[model samples]
Target: GAGVSQSPSNKVTEKGKDVELRCDPISGHTALYWYRQSLGQGLEFLIYFQGNSAPDKSGLPSDRFSAERTGGSVSTLTIQRTQQEDSAVYLCASSFLTASGNEQFFGPGTRLTVL
Candidate 1:
């Protein structure tokens, strides 16, 4: 029904802390994605989910980052042992199918500030 939504909008934590970010995609849309963008940087793909297909986790930056999608709708990304380098706007996006040629709607993102 609604467009994509993310929580907290902003976050601050010391290095090595764990954090979880949430995403809610639009109804009837079978495709979802997560991306990260540093200030003045391009979008960094994190993950994608579509129907029953195995998620594409290749974009995850490190072992500290992980995510999951349930029922083809909601998704969550957990970053373990956060780092100051992880500071960035973690954006979430969704589309009608696996990205590539498909346009994605993006969320405002959870801006994580790792100090």
Candidate 2:
């Protein structure tokens, strides 16, 4: 079994471009999470998906940010009309059954550079 994985480990785009980051969580894990780490800032929780439902989307930076998990395994985070400030590393994590304590396994992350 593989751990969490992300594609296009690094990306570079212009300020107004839209970007889609992908994450593949551990198989059979019921809980998936998305996080963003900006330069000089701590890791920020972006969203969470339990099965196919997202119960906590409050952490999305704005309406331009959205994510969805399909079939309880894979997820994609879309950032529309990206900005320079949006440059950051997007990380994904998954846990078995529930997302509690230190049980979550995190992906290496996708580094997005918005020029």
Largest TM-score belongs to which candidate? 2
lDDT of 2 by residue, 1-115 (tens): 7889998799999988999999999998899999999977789998999999999999998999999988888999999999988999999999986636749999999999999
Off by over 4 Å in 1: none
- lDDT for position 30 in model 2: 91
**TM-score of structure candidate 2:** 0.95
Angstrom error at residue 20, model 2? 0.3
Choose the strongest candidate by lDDT.
2
Put down candidate 1 lDDT per residue, 9-75, tens digits, no spaces: 9999999999999988877778988999987667788888886354688999998998888898888
* lDDT value, residue 23 of candidate 2: 96
The alpha-carbon deviation from the true structure for residue 2 of candidate 1, after best TM-score superposition, in angstroms, is 1.8
Q: What are the clash counts of all predictions, listed in order? A: 0, 0
